[model samples]
Structures are given as structure tokens and as C-alpha cells.
Target: MNARIEADAAFTDWMQHVQAGMEGTLDAYLPAVTEIPARLHQAMRYTALDGGKRVRPLLVYAAGELFEAPEELLGRAAAAVEMIHVYSLVHDDMPCMDDDALRRGKPTVHVRYDEPTALLVGDALQAQAFAVLSGNVEEQYAARQLKMLHLLAQAAGSTGMCGGQAIDLASVGMTLSLAELEQMHRLKTGALLRAAILLGACSGKHLTVVEQAALEAYSCPISLAFQVVDDILDATADSATLGKTAGKDAADNKPTYVSILGLSESQALAEKLRNDAHKALEQFGNKARRLHELADLIVQRKA
Candidate 1:
């Protein structure tokens, strides 16, 4: 196989592994409160097991690979990141939040279950993410795990995802500057992405200051690129192709890269960001092939 195809296959295999690990971890962690409610658990599984691109978890694993971390340890970290991501998505689709009816080519958690169930499921997933991290890791890594936990909490909490959602809500139908739009995405999407990469690196014995800076620089543009591509897909792709409702952003009159920069400009920006991400890995040379391929794949992803 060609290099690109080989990389794509590797990514696909890694994603499948991450999903299985996430499901297993969730099964073990979710039984903590099995006696209370069936619907809540159903809702939790509905959103959590709903297949996704699993990009965040993949990033975690890829970054860990750069440092030669063990696959089992990386799987645990990947599951933790994915749990946090699913929790954010569940809440994001709530009636009071994005009010999204579709997710992953199916009815969202709120639509499949109910708003209250969705709410609790999101909360449970958030708590369970920490539980997975704390419960599965060795005591020797406790301090590092705590740091990862803190990064996730900060990224998912009020100052990050929630804050970005609030801004998005407030900006609906309102014109925003390019800088403003970028800032919103930085907090909303980029923070968690950066945290994922950092968490993976943190699993190593140490990260040099330069490596830390490089990861941050790389994550910023890639996160925005991810969002930009999302907006483009929402505009041009169908629900079947995207596995979710299409054209919803335009329908909701939401501010997006397409709205602010136009489709062509958004595409150009995504390309530029992809290049920027690759550049950030220059120091790692051929050892960073997976990361480089991941950057290319993000820009080229149809879903």
C-alpha cells in the first residue's frame, strides 16, 4: 500500500481499538450506580456508544505514540478523552444548548431519550471520565493523571467548552469579526484538543518546554481547522453522508467560517492550518509521520 493509504488504515485500526477500549472502560465504570435508573444509563450509552470519528481519542493515542508510550496505557487515556468528548457532545445537543436534534447520523441524546436524561447522562459521563482515569491507572502515575484530570476539567468546564457555547449562543445571527470567531473556537474546541495532546505527552516521563510549546502551537490551528471543516460539511454534505443533520448551522443562522469567511476562504484557511500543523512537527522529522498524516486527514475528512 501507498504511504497515505497505509496511514489511513492505521488510523482506522487505531480508532477501532480506541472505541473498544472506551466501551470496555465505560462498562466497568458505569456500574457504580446501576441501581438508580435505567433510562439514564440508556441515555448515557445512547450518546457514548454512538459511533463518532473518535478524533480526540485518536489524537491522544497518536501523541502518546510519539513518546513510545505503551498501547495499554494509551488506550486508557484515549478512553478517558473520549468519555469527556461524549459528555460535551451530549450537553451540546441539549435543548438549552445547541438544541441539536441529530448527532452521529441519529437522533441526539435529548431526542432519543429526553432533555433531563440527556442532562444527567452528560453529567455522569463527565464524572465517569475522571473515575476512569483515577480507577485504571497505577499509583505511580497518580500525580500525572491528576494533572491530566485538571486539564480536562478546565477544558470542559465554564471557562472552556461551556464558555464557548455561551458565546456561540450569544452570537447567533450577530455578525462577528474573524478574530472573535477564532477566539470562540479556541475556547470551545481547541482547549480540549490541546488537552488531549498534552495528556498524551504527560503520560511520558516528561515533556520538554519546547515540546510543550510545539504541541500548543500545533493544536490551536488544527482545532480551528476541525471546526472550519465541520462548518463546510454542514453546508455541503447531507445528513446521511455526515451522519448527522446537515445545513443546521445555516438554518439556525449561526456564525460560522462559511458565514464569516465564505466557503472558498474557509477551505483555504483549513489548508493553511493543515500546513501550519505539519510545520509544528518539523523538529520530530520522520518520527512524526503519524501526526503529519493525521493533520492531512483532518483537512480531507468528509465526515
Candidate 2:
């Protein structure tokens, strides 16, 4: 595996640029701090604006940039995807789900506020996300934008992230094969990551079948590598660094790549996945540099 590092100042600068743009958009979409339903709106803003890596939005911008997509469309597309991601995290930390108390180095929604407020916050964000993506766009890209909405909806519904979380809840304390584990993560983690790429690409123009197939190739391994790294971090990193409970997977008896494959093999698998992601993007050459850098970040991330 190449494992090349783009550790230059430029890489950090680009990441901040994307993060800042999406962060500002999110703040704008959220209800005002003193809205009529002030408490619910406050909970929503608290979770959405608190802090996160915003990796999914970055992927949207990067892939859209590949086809010279319109900045207006791309910005909306990124914001919509990020809203869904934030909603998922809000519910995931609720009492019925992972029941986490801390997230992103702060109190989880349900922890900081009451449980009912947290529930409504998640529900509102999910609804608001689709509202952002429902408008018309460039004539040539109109159909593609609709397709992006469907992709995100399906990714969030029973067949995608929600379905994967169901599997996760059901599989606790039960043994699973590597293939089964991959299936779970594919829906849970991979679906959103893949949608980010497709939604971004769709924001620009229609991709030839061959070009989209290449994006799929890149997204599959890239998504899996991300989860593998998460598993590794859960085992090795601290709560302060991770911004969440460390070693919670083992404590909950949840199955993870590291749990089944051991630390050494999981690390090796992450490297292999990164290599596959790069190989899939070889056709795009320098145009895919952001994606290639993202794949490396997913695997090499410490938290």
C-alpha cells in the first residue's frame, strides 16, 4: 500500500475552507436562537452547530469540484447531507439507541437537554434536510438533483443507515462473519459516504456510466476503511481524544472489525482498502486528489 501523506499546509487549509463553508450554511438553516419554540430550536442548534469533522460535506464539495459543479447547488447539497448526518448522531446518542452521554467533546443532546427535546431535535433536522434539497436547480442538472435526493432518502431510510443501525442493535453479543460485518457497515457507514460522492457528482452533471462505476469502486472500500479506522480508534484512543466513550464497543459486546480480526489484521485491512480506493480513482488522475487525500485521512485518523 502506498500510504502517501499530503501533510502540507495546503491540505489543512483546504479542509478548513470546506468545513467553514458548510458550518456557516448549517447555522443559517437552523432556527434562530430566539425562535417561538426556543428550547427545541436551541437543542437543534446545539447538536448541529456544536462541532464535528463534517467529512460527508467535504466529500460532496470535493467530488462536485471534479465536474465544475455550481457553487450554489453544491453548497445546498452539502448542507442537506450534513443535516441528515447530524440527525443520525442525535438519535444515536439517545436513551433508546447507543445511549451515549458525550459526543464531539460535549454533552449529547439527550444528556444536555431532556430526552423528549432531543427526540424532537432529531426529527426536525431530518425534515429540514429534505426541505433544503427539494428546490429546482440548473436545467441540465435538474433530474440529477432529484436523483441525489432519492439517494439520500434511501440512504437514511430502512434500506440504508437506519437498516444498518437495526442490524447493529440486533447483533449485540452475537458473533458475525466478516461478510456480515461488512454488510452492516456498508449500510450504516458506507451508504452515507457513497451518497456524498454521488450527490456531489450529481450536482455538476450527469456522469457517464463508466465514470459513476469508478466512483462506486472508490466509495465502497473508502467507506469500509472509515469504519475500520473508527474501530481501531475505539480500541486504542482515549475518551478525550475520541470525544466519545472509548472502548464502548467491547463493553457493549458489539462486533467490530478489530474485535473479530484483531488489531494487526484490522490495520492491514484498512491499508488494503485505502489502496483499492486510490486504484479506483486512477482514471481521474489529479482531479481526484481531494478524494485520495480523504481516503488517507479516513484510515490514518487518530480519533
Candidate 3:
């Protein structure tokens, strides 16, 4: 197969594996939480199972595969990453935040259930992510697992996603510098992406300090590229194709790359970032092909 086709196939297989792993986690864990009300459970399951691109999970598996990590172990890590992502989305769509009524081509948790239930579901998903990590049977390295948990907590907590969200809310309708926009996205999206690759590498115990550094460098550009593409799609794509409301950022008066840099310049920036991301993986030879392709796919994706 051609490199791009092979990469797409690998990504498809990984997505199926991730979806199965996530369903398994829900089956195993949801029943154990007997105290959870049925409504809350429904809300949680509704949003959690809602279809997404599952990019973060794919990154986890790809990073692990690059290092020859075991499938079972990588699946566990992928599940954990996805749990965190779903939790963030549920909370982000609440009325107090983005107030989004739709996600993944369906009503958001708040729209389906209520704000309170949505909040609770988000909380439960976040807690369940740590629980899943703790329950990983294939984790032979205690120190590595602990490190992975720590990385996730930091990324999902005040220093990362939460912080970015706070800044984003504060910046509504206000013009921000390119530096400010980059700062916002680095914490909002980059931290988890960086952690996804790092945790996968850590799981395999195959990452040299230099390799870690290279991946970190690669993540920065790709993360920004991801956000830029999102901005572009928000302006151009509809909710049905995007799986979320289109033109929302502009409607909400949020500052975006498109607003700051213009559409053409934002696209050029994404291309430059994609090139830089590919260059960061050059040292790894063919083993890094998927990673490079992933960068291209992120910028080129319609949604």
C-alpha cells in the first residue's frame, strides 16, 4: 500500500480498537457505580458514545506502535485519553461555558438531559479516566503508570485545559495577539496531545530523552495546526459535516486564528506548521511515517 493509504488503514484499525476498548471500559465500570442515577448514566453514555474522530486515542496507539508497545497496554492508555476528551467536551458544551446545543451530530449532554446532569456526567467521566488508568492490568511499570497519571492530571487540570478555558472565556470579543492565541491553544489542546504521545512512549519504555524532545517539538506545531484547522472548518463547514455547530466561535465573539490572521494566512500557517511537524520526526526514518501523515491529515481534514 502507499504510505498515505497505509497510514489511513492503520488509523482506521486503531479507531476501531479504541472504540471497542472504550465500550469495554464503560461496560466494566458503569455497572460498578451503582449509586449513579439512571438519568446521569444515560447522559454520560449518550455523550461518551457519541461518534468523534478519536484523534487523541489514535495518537496514543500510533506512538505506542512506533515503539512496539503491546496492544493491550496501548488500548488502556487510549481509553484513558478518550475518557478525558469526552469529559472536557461534555463540560465545555454546558450553558455556563460554550452553551453548545450540538456535538457529534447530536444534542449535547446539556441539551439532551440538563445542565446539572451534564456537569455530573463530566465529573464522572473525569474520575473514570483515572480509574481506568489505575485498573490497567497490563501496566507492569508502576513508575511509568504513575507518570502517565500525573501527566494526564496536569493536562486536564488548572495548568492546561482548564486554564486555557478560563483564558478563552476572558478573551471573548477582545482582540488578542498571536502570542496570546498560541498561549491559549498550547494549554487548551497541546498539553493533552503532548501527553498522549508521551504516555504512549512511556508505556513502551523505549523513548530516549532526545526522542521525547523531538516528539514534544513535533506536538507544538501540530497542536497549533489542529486548532487553526478547527477555526477554518468552523467558518466553512456546517454542523452536519463538523459534528458540531458551525461558525460558533465567530458567533460567540471568541478570538480565533482566522480572526487574527485572516483565512488565507491562517491556512498558510497551518501548512508551515505541518511541514515543521514532519521535520521533527525526520530522525526516526520510516517508523515515523504515520506521525507525519497524521499531521497532514489534521490540516487537510474537512472536519
The best candidate in terms of TM-score: 2
**TM-score ranking, high to low:** 2, 1, 3
Select the stronger candidate by TM-score from 1 and 2.
2
Question: Residue by residue across 201-233, what tens digits does model 3's lDDT show?
Answer: 777865788999999988899899999999999
Q: Which stretches of candidate 3 lie over 4 Å from their true place?
A: 1-36, 136-139
Error of 1 at 50 (Å): 4.2
Provide the overall lDDT of each model, using Cα atoms, as 2-decimal numbers.
0.81, 0.90, 0.83
List, residue by residue over 1-303, the lDDT tens digit for candidate 1: 698788779767766876676667656556433566766776777677748877887788778877877655566677777888888888888888778888888898888888888888888888887777776557777787788788878888888887887888899999899999998988888888888888887776678899888888888878999999999999999999998778998999988999888999999999999999999999988877767777887899998
lDDT of 2 by residue, 1-303 (tens): 233344445677898999998778888777797888999988888888849899999899889978888987888788888999999999999988999999999999998999999889999999988988876666776777788889999999899999999999999999999999999999998899999999899888669999999999999999999999999999999999999999999999999999999999999999999999999999999898898889988888888
lDDT of 2: 0.90
Which candidate, 1 or 3, would have the higher lDDT against the true structure? 3
| Candidate 2 RMSD to the correct structure | 2.2
Instruction: Give the CA lDDT, 0 to 100, for residue 43 in model 1.
Output: 71
* lDDT ranking of the models: 2, 3, 1
